[model samples]
Target: MKKISITFLLVLISLIAQAQFTFKGTIANYSNKRILVKIDRAFDDILIGNITTNSNGSFSIPVKDNYSGIIEISLLDAKKNYIFISDNTDIDFSASITTNDEFIINIPGNQINERYQNYLNYDIKKNSILPQLQNINFYYNSKDDFYLPLKNEIQRISEMNEPDISEFPFLSYYLKTSDLIKNTEIGNGDAISNKNLILDHFKNAGQQFETSGVGKSLLYNYFKLSAMGATSQKDWENKIDKAIEVLLDEVGEETSRGQEILSATINFLNGYGLVNLTDKYMKRAESLTCEISAELKKTIQDNNSIKEGKIIPNIKFTHKLNDKYTYLYDIKTKYKLIMVWASWCSHCQQEMPYVKQFYENFKKSGGEIIALSVDYNKEDWQNAIKETSWLNDSDLIYWDSKFVKELNITGTPTLILVDQKNKILKITSKISDINNLIK
Candidate 1:
């Protein structure tokens, strides 16, 4: 039989089971501080591990594959309390005060935390409940009281819990605002056919996570982002050559250096999906990033491991803004972005109006965007850059900033960019891709 149906479709295309789970337990009243157990790690940010509480008050931590996270337990007589864990469910508890006690025995049941909580409930119903119902109809003109709470938050992201349409970017920005609210002629006509039936129920809930193969790079990046927003240059070069042959066979069998940095972020999203479908797909996305940097410079010059471009890894951080701070090859910028933030981040306050509109359009086409502010506070980084006028070159580094301990930058709206001989063209969290270096 066709070789047992091609060995059952290569055992169902390498069934990625156990998305992660085994948060071994024991956290009972810090027998001298050391709990930091963080977990959210599949593709960057959050994975510190530690456990110490035995002088009669246990502590243990290990969690992977039932993904949804946030399990902080920091101790010194209890105050750190971020606990949301959904899916591979074991979480033993007992945190006390007035003479302390903390315990969380064992937790396991992660069917990849119901598939990373249906890709974080379809990215909190397309970036926080349909962009907070278009910012409450752009400050209250009530689209019939925000259209049935935006179809009950797009039916709570079509009943969330397994919706990993290949790292769904808010289910491709709610199917590109449901084709501009379905072939325009703006708003109501039954609220644009109930916003095109909640973007045709997130395009049939992304074909049930593309029939459970968990979003083959989000179904070839929502068909090369709906054929490059309908300019369909030959259907966005046949969906960026089937999403760069399934992201170059999942970035050459990603055997986890965190899935090889999510296979170099699916080869920088297949080189920005062939630089948005042709200058011959940006010369086949710069020849697939020069054939993965000439097969990682012929496997690092056949294992001598340090030449072909040695000037690459330097990113540390720690300049501690004022109390005397200046690291990051000690300040000087013709062009620099460095950015990174945290003041109880709301996507670092919605990426400060796209990094203050790319630092006022890269300083009116001259460029320089420092910003730093890891906020240990010099008045919450001068009241969030004086309520976000965000004129560039602001600083306040703290969080141990020698460019965040040479770019270990755990996370918080990370940026980087650098130039005028600082070199690095991008590190990106995509605030309008730092105008691809003064365009």
Candidate 2:
């Protein structure tokens, strides 16, 4: 799993899926625009592919997935996404203006998507459209000729059965969770009841749900719902703790699912400025069983060093800085703010100035900045750091070098603070983490 980015989803696909497959589709009236293919990894999205539509509005890009999985295709110009489910074959769709608001289409060759659309249409009418019509009947025109036909049509569709997806287990899991999400959507009546329902679903969400795309949505929405009406910081954190604690009761910290949910929760909290809660949960994760998969461990641990209080060595850089220092050992300071980042990362770009400011603030007080670039292109790195003067170097190997392997650089803008003696003082991502540790 990659570092948590925007969107919440999970797709723990079946074992028979291939590492790479083609996802081809046509988008009418949307030509020559960038399209991003992405998958849910609980806390963040894994960008599988990026391609621009042809002048004819058609696109075909390679996607990494198992035979069966879920992915979201993002239209950069339209600012919209269409969710798709796979069933071991190449999944294709034909889209246009008529399907603008409705992304789901049950066209030829995609029975899984058809069934999913059936549920989506059914739920909207029964829960949203049906309720609105009932409001009109009770208040506006109960005896009008227009009312009778409209009511009957709405009633018929609302009472219709949901799509039968018994044969496809992936579709079944997705839709069932979709129904629960609809029930707990914001502005639904009975806030108290919906909150309890969210908590209950959090407890019952198993690997089938956690490993799929919608799994992340459950946790994402729960965090939003919990913080909807907080009057105080204590209340906000208490609500978050309540939901997380409920989930922990069902899954232990040692299990993969447990670690995933916990890691997702921590990343979300940290992103939203709940650093204290983030620390509390991260410490808890660190103490769990270390037998989990290495890829999964990156999401939680976010580093490769012997955590805190340990001497961190093997800090190597490829180029010389100002024709002087090349590694952490060469820096003459009591504390070192080591920044591991890539030029292409948007988040890293946003946080660079603050790190530079921090380094300047502490420069005279025994501090130095050592930037480790994971950029394979030297020009990109040079352009990125053109205005800054700091110790910069890279192997230009991009996550495959021994330097990255030894450090286990979790994600871009991975900022760590260590002393001259190579003792790692802190491992953090945000300025708040550094300030919190130093102060």
The TM-scores, one per candidate, come to 0.24, 0.61
Model 2 segments more than 4 A misplaced: 1-21, 62-65, 77-79, 97-109, 134-152, 155-161, 185-206, 221-231, 303-439
Steric clashes per prediction: 43, 11
Lowest lDDT sum, 10 consecutive residues, model 1, at 302-311
Model 1 C-alpha lDDT per residue in residues 73-147, reported as the tens digit of each score: 444422343343433456544443344344432322244334434555566677667666655544544467766
Model 1 misplacement above 4 A: 1-84, 87-237, 241-316, 319-329, 332-439
**Residue 242, candidate 2: alpha-carbon lDDT:** 78
Q: Give per-residue CA lDDT, model 2, range 1-439, as digits (tens).
A: 3544222223324322434566788877768766777765544555666567899878876555454656777763324667887665676778764544444343623777777777778878877788788777775476677877877877797679976889888888777777777767788767667767766765566555644666567776776676678889899888878778767766666666666677677666665657678778877777766676565466455533445677777566676767877666877777877788888878888887787777666776767777787775557778988877767777654554346656655467777788778888887777658865553
When summed lDDT is taken over every stretch of 10 residues in candidate 2, the lowest stretch is 6-15
